[model samples]
Target: MTRGTVILKNGKVFIALGYSNSDSYPSGEIGQMLVKALSNSSDEETVQIIRELIGGLQKDEFSKDCMESLREIGEAFYNKKAATKVGLDDVYGYYYDYSYVYDIKTRKLQIFHFGQLEYSFKKEDFPFLRLVVENDELLYTLSYDTKNKCFKGIDAEVKKVKRMKKAGKSPQYILEIAKSLSERIHYVVDEVYSSDCWPNAVQKGVTFYPSRKRLKFIFKENYGKWNVYIQLPWVRQGLIHNCTSRKAAMNKLIAYLDGNWESFQSGMDLYELYEDCQQKLMNFYNACDQISITKDEFNESVGQIEKEFRGKLIPLEELDYSGWTKAFGPDRAKKEIANWIFMTHRHIFDCIQKA
Candidate 1:
């Protein structure tokens, strides 16, 4: 049996790519076509052909092993300087094991974002996917490792439940899935403490925060992976830090309770405060560009400000420029409402001043 070479981007598995013959393949023609497909990352068409060759064989021992590697090597055509050689370098060629690619991606991803957990389909019909969850995070790629043969990273452990179906384009649905998964992992240790988990009053004594500020763990999705962090009322911004695993997340939550966590910023109700500030800022900004300032100006200015900041004392009644009463002067209207709003915000609470 004569041969041709199918060089792969990865060279971890340097074994012989079987010679062409009539039994498994018609000739070396099939081999060259595979190389082309892999080079282009031709998803559907190439994947379909490779499927027939692999059939039901274990990945490492398949007849179409080298060609199957197109799943990974095909990511970007095989360039010697930037590729890994898979299978043996006979005339028949090399292929990707996807498992090797998964490992390589895992190592490379750690260099950039340790929280990234990337995964993808290695073959068109292959039920198992590749997964890569980077360090200290209950990280695994069902799409990197065999979520069944799941890997343990620095601070996290991973397992694959059934693939999420509702994790579609819906933000609310995805958030729900993330919350469920995160809390399920949390309940394993700290009564649903981490994993995008919400802080609950545990018997009024066990609290995630020393203050009444609600500390919610956030698994903010970054691309396909998640940027796992916390959302605390005291935090001025999100993405406080990466929580690599379920256990690590709980440990950090403990830090907050123990009054030891060093956050980027600290103040109560920061997100809501930011929302209020943004609304007011935009209202002021829009007013500045207006050519004329009359009823429209009042509508935009007084209307928006009142809408956003409703006073605890009294509602912002509509302006009555036409029927101005002598006793209820304009100065008091501005003082009791607008000035009060400003003063209430300006007055620094002791907790904030101390913090």
Candidate 2:
């Protein structure tokens, strides 16, 4: 059982429902306050209580009314694209957006949306809150108790989380929740793009697609600027590649592959790749340093490697099924990840080169 709590940062509040034992965390203070506020609110009037609480916050800590404020934060984060020089989104990190409860007897996963955000496709300042007008539902209530009684509510997200543990499920991983929610929100955002394309219709300045060459890249169009990310196919928590204006997130990822790059390029088949392709990459890495390579240079260099490797290499689409580093231990996962990057990255490049 995982629970959610709203954390206040720099006067802005982010939801952190998945955190357990809040006593040791810095966000515990706000998390405690939020739990207190939610537990004390009128059981029959959750939405109203949230609104009243939000309306009662001070200026410096404006996010007290988190549900309403998230819309504002999202707008502020995304609206930068309209400017000639877009700034970084203020709310960049993962937030606890949803809580899951499991029944020991039934083994069912009940998902609860954390704040007023819709958690679905909707057009408005904040995607989640737009659902308020469409339905008379309360925020932060567990799925089981949501339909139970209007007055019944849990004081802490940990209440359900405890039961989940006994039932043999540990609700951990802050990034896991953040990544899952972010992906869902992105889906909603995508629908808006294909159809509504918020703040304005027919928005065409930004686009995203995979690479079509021998390497994997996420071609990104921000406003009118273009960049690419070296894709780490094994990563599940969202964009593993970080990006700056001049370079993609590949620099860091390339560093992870350094040992293998060295070994393979040194005429040693570290992971049994097709000999021909390894020889080509050996030549490339032996002759060049990736740290100084630019995107166009990378594109130009792909041809020879692609010609040699291409489909001759087998791809490890997924490494584990148990997940949460279950297939292998952490060290083993790390090794496999490095090998996977060397073997599979170019395949993504082959798929999206022209797009």
Candidate 3:
């Protein structure tokens, strides 16, 4: 895969180009289709098809025709000299066992960003939240390997869960939590942490900060196969530097590092104060763990669970949410339903804006 990443200030925009490893694909197909998509009457449809053709598979395993088409499409995005000379290639293709592609098909394509990375976001008000977007029942298998020193693999076989009904469109349900934070403009912080597993986070996507200030997001994928991430260090650091005290800075810093309220809020005082700023920063980020059991962590964690825990878990449908009515009594359930309705209406404006 020929991949490139260009981080621009303020997240105004960026672009990326990459190839699917599907051997069935040819080199220039991605480039060629990108050009065709830009010119097509239905830009969204064309782009969707192109994205699926290249991104919807694992590495080097694509149809030869697909790869060639993508390469040609990628070349069309830039001058022959520029596209040909861009020294982007996938080195961990043999190691990570997966691939990614990011493309910015607009303007002169001043910035193209691409990497196998992942990150998450939430409103400052909601902290104890988890978002479950898309029900991709991924399964994982275990194989012994001395090279995987970072994580202990649970010996298992590769297989899919049987007797399971596939879910339709993925759900984007994530919990939300909030905390008070403050920050000044123009500062950057770099932090290093360990992965939650041997393989680090291997996901990729882009974010836009539309605000009228310069910003930088930098990170290196040194963690593990597909498990690396980038963050707005300056933004995060600036917030830390301006807090009420060293302790406050430490708390907020730890919060960001943990990314989950459940993990961050455990076994600690919410209002504890730190006496030293440097110490606080060091202490907070030093403990951050990079590994996560997110569904995407594997192409098939669900299969592993089903195969390993055959009769331990019940069918999802059996746990009827409305069953709560019987347990708590119908009147209470009705009251709860009324509260839900009220909350829904109150948040209608927010939903429309997001939509």
lDDT of 2: 0.31
Better of 2 and 3 by lDDT: 2
TM-score of 3: 0.18
lDDT of 2 by residue, 1-355 (tens): 3334322222233321123322322123322333333344343343333334333433333333433544455423212232213343333333344422222223122223332222221111121222222221122212222111221233243233323233333224322332332222100001111322222212111111111112232435455443433322243222232345323333333333332322212212212344344456556654444245554676567555554343433232232223121322334433554475457546544433533
Two-way lDDT contest, 1 vs 2, winner: 1
Candidate 1 residues lying further than 4 Å off, grouped into runs, are 1-44, 47-125, 130-157, 160-180, 185-253, 257-270, 273-277, 294-300, 311-355
Who wins the TM-score comparison?
1
Model 1 Cα lDDT, one tens digit per residue, 1-355: 3222222222354222222323222123443333333333445554444444333223344436545654445433222223335432342233221221211221110011111222332332121111111111222211132111112241122222323222222323433433444433211112332333333211111211223233344444343333334432223234324555434544554444333221211322333443464457455545444444344554466546755544421322333322111323233433445544454433322222333
Off by over 4 Å in 3: 1-45, 48-165, 169-267, 270-272, 275-355
The candidate with the higher TM-score, 1 or 2, is 1
Error of 2 at 120 (Å): 9.3
Q: Candidate 3's error at 45, in angstroms?
A: 5.6
Best lDDT goes to which candidate? 1
In model 2, the runs with Cα more than 4 Å from the true position are: 1-31, 37-42, 45-49, 59-245, 252-355
Q: lDDT scores for all predictions?
A: 0.32, 0.31, 0.27
